[model samples]
Target: MLDAVADLLLEAGYDGLTIDAVAARSGVHRTTVYRRWRDTGGLLADALDAAREVPWEPPDTGSLAGDLTEINRQIVAALTEEPSITAALIAASFRSPAAAAALRSFWEDRYAIAAIVVERVAPGVPARPVLLASCAPVFYELVLLRGPAPGDELAERYARLAAASVSRSGAAP
Candidate 1:
């Protein structure tokens, strides 16, 4: 049922995703779907939670610059390949508290991976802002700024530049 709901959203976006549609597609009775999910927001949130977890692996790489570059590269790739329904879900989050909370839960895993990299790279540096900014450029370029997506080369360049800037501050050696 959850997979059915997620697929509907992915294929048709939020507006087209109706509980009735999910019920019909999944062969479950509409009442059953309603009873379990209550609303579209609840249904989507559970589906998001039930989906596979993104693994976190911090590459030692012997140098902070290399490790950060690799990490950001993988992160960008992951986001690009992420299901389109996720964007719809994110948009829905603005109107629904349940969706918002679910979005936070999904992002928390990514942040945890970012934190580990930051700790290894720049031990004492505050994790949140630095990590946020480090990844922000790629997202800005691709999503908000509507610029070209950063390829591996550019990701590495940005990561290296960040690493150099941070290293000059005597943090990640």
Candidate 2:
């Protein structure tokens, strides 16, 4: 049921996703869905959780550059791959308090995962802000400012620059 709702939410945006629609798509009773998840927010939250990426394991390649490059690459791929989901969630967040809360939760988890990798690479520097700032130029300029990078080259460049900055900060080196 959650998967069915998630599919609908991803494809149709939050406004278009209805309990009845999910029930019809999933072949489950509307009453059952309502009973299991009483509200749209709750249903959407569950679906988002189900759709989240599993944690990526950090690698100790003895080089922060390589590890961070891989991490950022993965992040770029994941973000770019889900245009509909991102659009729907962003749109939902603006109008729905529940979706805003869910987005907060989602971002927290996403940052936390990245923080772990940053902590491993640079033990002293703070992870969350630094990492976010490092990638902000790319995501902001691409996603918010310009509209996505030209290709993997731009993402790779961002990763390398981020890794270099962290490495040069005189933390672990």
Candidate 3:
């Protein structure tokens, strides 16, 4: 089961994830686990695939800044939460090519759903880069730079900055 996979992966890291451990944890039998998912990467990719189907909707707060700020807050929480699955999966992606691909697919789906927020603000502007501009600092600060979260005010400020950039470039005011 993917639940078992996530738990085991988190407990032991990519090097410790094994069909036997997952089978024991899930009570699914090692043979069944192996037949269904040949290796740790397969299990990781399958978990990401399952996660992609979970229902999600971008924040809709009647303004671009509000929506983007809410999104950044969500990112901060996901990155900092206890037993952080987002952090675990992000780590796994670097160790497994399959996980890397699956993570990419998961984000693509996420961005597509989040695009509606941008579409409501600017009909003709591309949403992907704008969404990146709004969300990148959260990840960069938390993951790469290892800095404390920027918090809500800074999150809102980042949203304001991103919105202003787009607004100046011909998006709706």
Candidate 4:
């Protein structure tokens, strides 16, 4: 059912997604979906929650730069490869409280997992800004500028710069 929701969300934006569509796609009874999810927002939230359960383990490349670069590469792939789905989710998050909360939870969970890489390298430094610095440029280019998605080389450069900044200053970027 969650898989069905993901597919439907990719096919149709949040406004077009319906309980009936999810039920039909999943071959589950409408009543069952309703009983499980309660409403469209709940269903979407649960679907996103379910999708996020697939853990994205941070790389243990021995160096913070390597780990951060890998993380940025993954971010670029997700934002570029699934632009429609990502955009739909982002739009839905702004309009739907359930989606917004779910998205927040998703990021919090992912960051907690990924923060280990930063912690391992910079024991006393705050990890959030360092991690954000590594990926913010790619996001800015892709989301704000509406430009071409950055490739791995850009990700690596950002990661190296971020790592160097944090390592040298013991401060978050």
Q: In model 1, which runs have C-alpha deviations exceeding 4 angstroms?
A: 52-55, 82-85
User: What would the per-residue lDDT of candidate 1 be over residues 69-89, giving only the tens digit for each residue?
Assistant: 777786567556657565567
The better candidate by lDDT, 2 or 4, is: 4
* Model 2 stretches with alpha carbons more than 4 Å out: 52-55, 59-61, 82-84, 146-148
Q: For each candidate, what TM-score against the reference? A: 0.81, 0.79, 0.94, 0.87
Tell me the whole-model lDDT of each prediction, alpha carbons only.
0.72, 0.70, 0.86, 0.81
Model 4 segments beyond 4 Å from truth? 82-84, 170-173
Tens-digit lDDT string for candidate 3 (25-86): 99997998999888899999999999988999899999888898998888888888777788
Ranking by lDDT: 3, 4, 1, 2
Error of 2 at 152 (Å): 1.8
By lDDT, the better pick of 1 and 3 is: 3
Error of 3 at 54 (Å): 0.9
Clashing pairs in 1: none
lDDT per residue as tens, model 2, 1-173: 87776678787777777888888999998999899877777777776676566564555566655666666665566556755565567667777677778777877777777677678768978887666755566566555665754656666677677777777888864
Cα lDDT of candidate 2 equals 0.70
Error (Å) of candidate 3 at residue 81 is: 0.3
Cα-based lDDT at residue 76, candidate 4: 75
C-alpha RMSD between model 2 and the true structure:
2.7
Model 4, 142: alpha-carbon shift in Å?
A: 1.8
